[model samples]
Target: MRESKALQVLKGRHLRLEEPLLLSTVSGVASTKPALIRYFDQKISPIGIITTKSFQVTPNPGNREPVICETTKGNFGNSVGLRNPGMDQALAELRALRQEWKFRCLLNVSLSANSVEDFIMLVEVFSEVADILELNFSCPHAAEGYGASIGCSSEISSDYVRKIKEATKKSEVPLFVKLTPNVEDIGQVAKAVVDAGADGLVAINTVGPIVHEDPVSHTPILQNTIGGKGGCSGRWVHGKAVSCIKEIRMAVGDDVPLIGMGGVSTGEEAAEMVLCGADAVGIGSAFGTVSQKDWEPYLNSVLAEAEARLKPGKEYLGPKSETYLAEDRQMAYRKHTVTKIAYYGKDTIILTLDGSLPCKAGEFAFLWLPGIGEKPFSVAHNDPLTFVVKKRGPFTEALWLLSLGSDLYVRGIYGAQLENERTDKALLVAGGTGVAVLPALAQQLKEQGTEMTILVGTSESVAGKALLEDRLSGFGSFTCVADDGKNGRVLDLLNGLSLGPDQACYLVGPEIFMAIAAKKLILQGMEEEKIYLSMERMTLCGIGMCGECVCGDRLTCQWGSFMRYDYLKEHAPSMVGL
Candidate 1:
């Protein structure tokens, strides 16, 4: 019968909220414009505040893929390399969100600069539009001389915060410094920032630049090949967050507000943060469970539970401590025994595993061979976790020679999947091994009762033609164009087809080929939004955290593997070679 006490005043500003919960930066899910629009439109509950993904002055291409890996339940290790669309584009998107945002919003800004001027400039610019400014001083994955590089040094952290406060003096924007948990003493860092005029603090950014490896491959699972260290977040980092918040709260002595965030996934965790001296708790990663529609109910359940436990004048009890075992921190790469391997087409082979892995169409996994390393491949089939492999590099070449009963490590179900828009008809275009992702899409379309047509192109036709036909059997209408055709290019086949107003097209192949086909479809009067293409990039992390698979402003691992031509044209034209 009473309103939740989650709404509290910070720095003389009151955050009107339905509940106390705040969605932390879940990167691709919480930081993107499209994702935010959906969240606001759906009115997801406990929306005390929303924070954008950390952005810097310049566009960061990030690192190569295999950027993120789940070490255990609710634990993720990621080295995203601070990928963002730079200041100009970031400002434009922020302005757009300002116009539409009904809830309080904080812009999370990071700086990877040689001098403090860039940091000041960012603060000055963002202070004008954002309700609150979060200075990301603790991004462990940032390039050298940035993020944690700055935060770890008390003098540098103080100087940066001092300059930022001075820069925003005119705007009087509240500055919240986000600190790193990897430091020797986070409390000391917190004190330095607070002394330098930080209005608040976000305790414990991701912990550790941890590494994970594939046991079979005896190599790092991340595409960076070395398993470069990445920050750890989720359930595993919850204790670290609590300890950091406790220390900061002790250091700041209840004056500076501390926002505790790390691996918070439930209402109990939220309450635990409050008890640990957090003025407010930020929740992320947990929302990965359901769609935007379900967020309100999910948050309500979380808040209700928190409300019941966090009564007035509750005493602070220390968090329960636990030890993490080797298995707890390790990557979950399942060892699948290869049951079958057969040549599909020239240079192409289909590998069938002894057991199945749950996956969706368009999702991919890392295939690991000990001493040979691991690489990502689109799932050719789900039931038995099949992969259509091509001998493109050392990994694939090694995979080609793998005999029956050979052990391989497969981990994933990453990237966005092809969704049915309920269109009357759908056209699928595949070039080379891009055909591997098609069977799953065709099957989904068929189940949805959407008439489907597939046009596949290969450099050379061998048993591969028959192999493709067998995969698509009973799924859709199929056609093929090979180099042996009158024209050697896949684009030549698109000239004869017509896309109607009610039709949609999905393309996957070499970048140039897809770009040409997309251009052709658009020229034929197809709405750019109706045309989709799969982008191939060196994906380090299948999640958006690793900036390796960025296509212009979008992360191919998160925003797309399948993306709309119109959206790309407007936001990321470079992605489509426009």
Candidate 2:
């Protein structure tokens, strides 16, 4: 009798550090090219397997803001629109990973397409860099003719898997088929793909394209929700994931490798997956709760817990000295009372709260109104915590009507602390309501003892110039742009200013405005790397879990809201478009 190949462990090829547990990170957690490649650089990631988010044949801008909402502990509903940089860019990212990360982990590249021909083509090309190729057949909310369309039918899934395996057979890269649980029979689908030459199988994708809405508004939160439905994962799918794995194992027997995932957040759950018939467990929505720094220890604890659960009478291994995900303050919300609301014009106002959370320049915080909805806003002042709110949407309109001393909930300051980039002279440019990120930024420059000039541009009437100048001009020389047949536009003022290599500019505003400003600075002889543009967009989850906050390839929530022009040009061109 011999040990089945299916039961074979995923031992590190080069890591001699004993038999490490087989832990894998699902796509969309460290999904982007920069995040996936850079996260493993410091070896902070303890997991042995990394799955790239499903890359399409073409780039997807994803859905609009409010694409993700946390429904319960370790569970949330999301409609990220299957966002990815498409194939060519994704290939470049994988190539960079080859050049940078030489660690002892398996690189799993996941692919999604409408037809078997495209799937085969992807396999032929990506097999060059992939240790494993995961076929994403189970994304519940993907567009028609893709994902669940192929996964729901055993014949279509088998056909796709068979052709892809044939195309990449010479490459010897392991082929894993990820199937949907929304099908008629999980076992039949599992049997079909395995019989078609799937080397392994990943049981369960998201459970449903279920609708999650704000209680009071009775309106949909996710922008791409079709018929008001988005994919459901995390705590809600735990039981279904376990049962699906059990059915998949019973159907395929103990000869094929299987990865079970769905709402798996704890060690006990991981153990349960294995007992039911999973070779390795995949973790997804749980990452939504853990901050970037805590990813390593949290996974380590889950791995430890999974191993412990297997032992019949295991003794208590004592407390985990490393901080766990549940304890991370990033997820907790603090209640605060609204003390003051400055009516700086009808649209722009400064709302002050009694308490504060640790925030920094360029970072943002989420304000949640019970029974209403939550939205992210930049903190202008931290002590007695103040926010510069622009009355744009329903959320801001509610804030405008909020009575004084009303209780409100707030959490985070998401991005990392802004590092002081020393310069002889500095330029601060802001437009419209983007002035929120300016005050804190000005404060930092002032403390650095660096000479800075501030430029404010507004679409609104410049009649309230004194009110803004009173709060802003204290840092350095200040100029307001008013094109009222008196003063020319902000660009005209920028044209007359001095520009040099030794000067750094921090610019944030409307995307087109910032892009044009960055281009102007570069044209005026400032170094491209010296100009930092705010990359904040679609920031629903304060953490990078939702994949909604991605601006180009970088998730601004974790990668810092302000990025240099040189970096953006090569990675995110739209941020510096001409």
TM-scores for every candidate against the unseen true structure:
0.73, 0.74
Error of 2 at 508 (Å): 5.1
Tens-place lDDT digits, model 2, residues 1-578: 23322224531211222333476778765544555445543454557677888888788776654556764445677777788888899888788768765746677889889988888878877877787788999888888888899999999999888887776667667788999999879999999999998878887888788877654344555666376578888778899989998899899887778888888777778778878877777877777666655677777788777667676565437444234545443444567889987765547777888976667786888887754567888887788788877888877888888889987777676877676579988999887777778878887787887898898876546454455567788888888775444322676667746786678999888788888787777767888878888776756677767555665555677767888788778866755673
Which regions of candidate 2 fall more than 4 Å away from where they truly are?
1-18, 100-103, 311-323, 327-360, 365-413, 416-433, 441-461, 464-467, 474-477, 481-540, 547-578
lDDT of each: 0.68, 0.74
Write the residue-wise lDDT of candidate 1 on 12-120 in tens digits. Answer: 1212233354444444334455335334334554655566667778888676545666755557767667767888888887677667645444444333453588878
lDDT of 1 at 119: 78
Worst 10 residues of 1 by lDDT: 318-327
Please estimate how well model 1 matches the true structure, expressed as its whole-model Cα lDDT. 0.68
- RMSD after CA superposition, every candidate: 7.0, 6.4
**In terms of TM-score, which candidate is strongest?**
2
